[model samples]
Target: MENFDAIVIGSGQGGNPLAKKMAEKGWKIALVEQRQPGGTCINDGCTPTKTMIASARIAHLLSRSDTWGIRNQGYTVDLPAIIARKNEVVQQFRNGTVKNLEKAGVTVLMGTAVFSGVKTLTVTMHDGSIRELTATHIFINTGAAPFIPEIPGLRDVPYLTSTSLQEEVKVPPELIILGGGYIALEMGQLYRRLGSTVTIVEKSAQLMSKEDPDVAAVIKKILEAEDIEVYTATTTEKISGTQDHIEVQLQTAGKSHIITGTHLLVATGRNPQTAALQLSKTNVTLDEKGYVQVNDQLETSCPGIYAIGDVKPGPAFTHISYNDHLILYKNLFEEAELSTKTRQLPYCMFTDPQLGRIGLSETSARQAGYPVKVAHLSMDKVARAIETGETAGFMKAVVHEHTGQILGAAVIGTEGGEIMSVLQMAMLGGITATQLRDMIFAHPLYAESLNNLFMTLEK
Candidate 1:
């Protein structure tokens, strides 16, 4: 048996940094990963998907070059080349992660790890050898995996998830996607731009069901204009077909229908990846949904054991996971007082015109019983959007009427993510909408539109 000062299972966004930080502090540490070192973000989620999204955006823009008077033709997407480029980017980031761990003197272990006792773990190495290791503190950052719903015949037929779809080199002639969340919208736009006939079936009443109906409607309009079919309030009954072709039987609004396509992508949701961790053998308790239960300090029921990122019940985002690492490191090692509570929640969905959001939505603010004031502006009215000919969405903000404070804001146009950050900073600094409207912003930029957007609410 071997012992270490600390052991971090799963080299994900949280574990990767925390392990390196601990090792650099002169503590012997062990980092265990069953598969790749970079976890979901570098290997499958943010890095690779966004890289492919960039290709899709280029293809989309080239297809409309005539509108810009470019007079271009014979545009086509080279699928294998795009895949190669994405693979190259992923590899580069993964190598950097491994190098960071090695530089900090972390003992990298390639195997599956499970708790045999409190602070004790047994690893089945990748080469079929078993090793026993113990540590004074253990951290579980094993992220979640794609959840394949139990629809009849869905599993029997070959289907792609968010992870597997990125590796595909061949663009399907006809693609049918399940779910209407961020993953579905991203992949749907990606394949549609790559010359595939894309159709999205969402069980919810609208795309991005969590967003306000008006916000969701704007996205639906943009996608429908791109020739992508979206069916909402639809339930997928079953799937049947071979690898090359698939037929999905579904129901929407009491009507039954069948949609056939050359390929199918499932983006329903994800569940915590804890079944193999053998948590029952330890004192760690899981929530009803199977996510590891953690206090505000991110410590599990077990005294020194901790869980973070998607493994715990929180928003699944790369930035949030990295913040988890920061919170854990500061409080535990630096003797600083901090917590996962009362932090700003900011997220962006990387579609054609990104959906950048922070703080409360209009619905949530109203539901919370706050008298809310709203301002909405279309992108076509913005000087930059009109000048660049990329106007296809809008910007909306929810404010507290009495407090004159900005509550939340959502941007759904070109560079929406960047523009949303301005509002996020204002909220963080306690700047009201009136103050922001009166502030001088650079001319003819997307951000300048904020003045007009808030001006409408001044009344």
Candidate 2:
């Protein structure tokens, strides 16, 4: 039997940080994880995905070397090498996380932890040994799993989820992807750049349906130009496979079509990882969608138990999970009141011409009864964009017409993710448009577009 002041389940983004903070506060902390210490984002999700994207971007730039007067012969993508490098990166980070947790004086438990009773957990270790743990406070940050949707014949056919596909060292000749979100777009582009004939089927009206329609359309244009076929407002009717190929039946515009590919990757969204936690033993409540229900302070129905990250209902980004750690830290140790609503969160999509947005959209602002004014500037018009020979997107800013306060900003271009932080900070700090316009920004940079964007807004 082991006792601790706090027991954190799952040593991912949320659990690792929470355990470290509590241990630093002179509390005995037990960090429980069934798999690798770094969790999904470090292993199969963000790190691997971004490394693959970087490789894809290099391949893309090499293919476009003609524009720079460099007559490059044909290039080949060593898919196996790329996959090996990605795995190397994931392993390095995962090992680093394990070391950091140990240095923090956290007692790491490797096992499947289940609820034995209120504030009690029976951790079943890998060797079939059992250990009981009791804690005064418990944090559940089990994260989420990829959602595999049920399509007729999908179960029998061989298909890859996001996690499974990361293990592939060779690129398929023809790839068919279902679900048109960020993951699908990114992986589709990566494989397409590596010489795969990729096709994307999106059930929504457009790819990246969560973003503004205009932003999604611009991304679709860029993707089509890359020779990747995209079918929007489509449904995957069925799937069938053989040793060499897989056939996907898709329905779009009330018309049925079959597409054949050597590989099938499903980029559907995720669901909370709560099924194994056995929440019925505790007072914790879950919504219909299976996410643990929590108050604005991230507290579950049970006292002294909190949930964060994908297990709770909110955006499921790595940064958002880190922010949750901050909120939970304040509530637990700093004696400060914290809530999810108190933070200004932002989201980014890492595609060619990445898309990033913060706060309310223009449509949302208008619907919320704010008289909104929108200012947009094309990347082509920015001087630095012209100098860089990569000017194929735009920046849009939405503001309240009466107060000139920034309601939201969306950037889709080179360094869109970097430029978004300035706008995000402005919105979070309540900085008005006039303040942004008056501030002197560095010359001849991608971020200079912000000066032009805010200038267009009529004050």
Q: Highest lDDT: which candidate?
A: 1
lDDT of 1 at 306: 93
Count of clashing residue pairs in every prediction: 0, 0
Q: Where is the poorest 10-residue window by lDDT in model 2?
A: 450-459
Best-matching candidate per TM-score: 1
Candidate 2 stretches with Cα past 4 Å from truth are: none
lDDT of 1 by residue, 176-227 (tens): 9999999999999989999999999999999999999998999999899999
Error of 2 at 262 (Å): 1.0
lDDT of 1 at 115: 88
- Which residue pairs in model 1 clash with each other? none
